[model samples]
Target: MHSKTYILISFHTAELGNPDIVFLISIVLAFTFIMFLTCEILLQGSLRDHSEPNDEYVIPHGDWFEIVSSPHYLAEIVIYAGLVVASGGTDLTIWLLFGFVVSNLVLAAAETHRWYLQKFESYPKKRLAIIPFAY
Candidate 1:
């Protein structure tokens, strides 16, 4: 592999100690996370005008929604995953928050996915409920 040179921004603090490789990796991962969030938001915004005030909005369709029932929830998980990495993945607080978030979103997506199937007979079978293939 061809390695590129980089700069380090370190602060030796008594409480938190010094920044290291994981922190830097997390910073890069943050960019990926924000992109996911931005896409999810913009996509949902495009669909919002077409799907409100009617009961039809319960079942999201088109784009990422076409593939998974709740893409925004997926995005939220990804954003939190980025944070988990940013925190070096050992923070119990972040892990618990991530767990709760995943659980809640999964439940909601399951309900929404069921609704989509019930509401639209033509809802894609290949598409998942949430969390891609696992869900």
Candidate 2:
């Protein structure tokens, strides 16, 4: 009982000395750009019309919207995925965060997909709820 000691906290070391840092940084930056691009596309595609989805409801006709009901959500998952990959996936914390993001987004996307199908008979039949060609 006298030997009880507090656990010491260790800080994550900077990987700037490693060559892999360059590659990892590039990947992270690329995905960050992609995330912003997806957001812009969503804003561009949907914000123009004052009307909510109806019979004439124009779902974003091009790009990711053609593939999934929730491009924004997919983009978010991709962003986190990039972070996980950049961390070399040794960090369980990042993976747990990624899982949380995926679960929440999947649920939202699925609900949105259901609403889209119910509201519009012409909703792209081939499009997936979230993950393309799988979900």
Highest lDDT model number: 2
Superposed Cα deviation of residue 94, candidate 2 (Å): 1.6
C-alpha lDDT (0 to 100) for residue 109 of candidate 2: 95
Model 1 misplaced regions, further than 4 Å = 1-8, 12-24, 39-46, 49-59
Q: lDDT score of model 2? A: 0.77
Best by TM-score: 2
Cα error, candidate 1, residue 119 (Å): 1.8
TM-score for each prediction? 0.70, 0.71
Model 2 Cα shift for residue 81 (angstroms)? 1.0
Clashing pairs in 2: none
Clashes of each: 0, 0
The sequence of per-residue lDDT tens digits that candidate 2 reaches over residues 69-127 is: 88888888888888887676779999999999999999999999999999998788999
CA lDDT of every candidate: 0.71, 0.77
Q: Which ten residues in a row have the lowest lDDT in candidate 1?
A: 1-10
Report the alpha-carbon TM-score of model 2 versus the true structure: 0.71
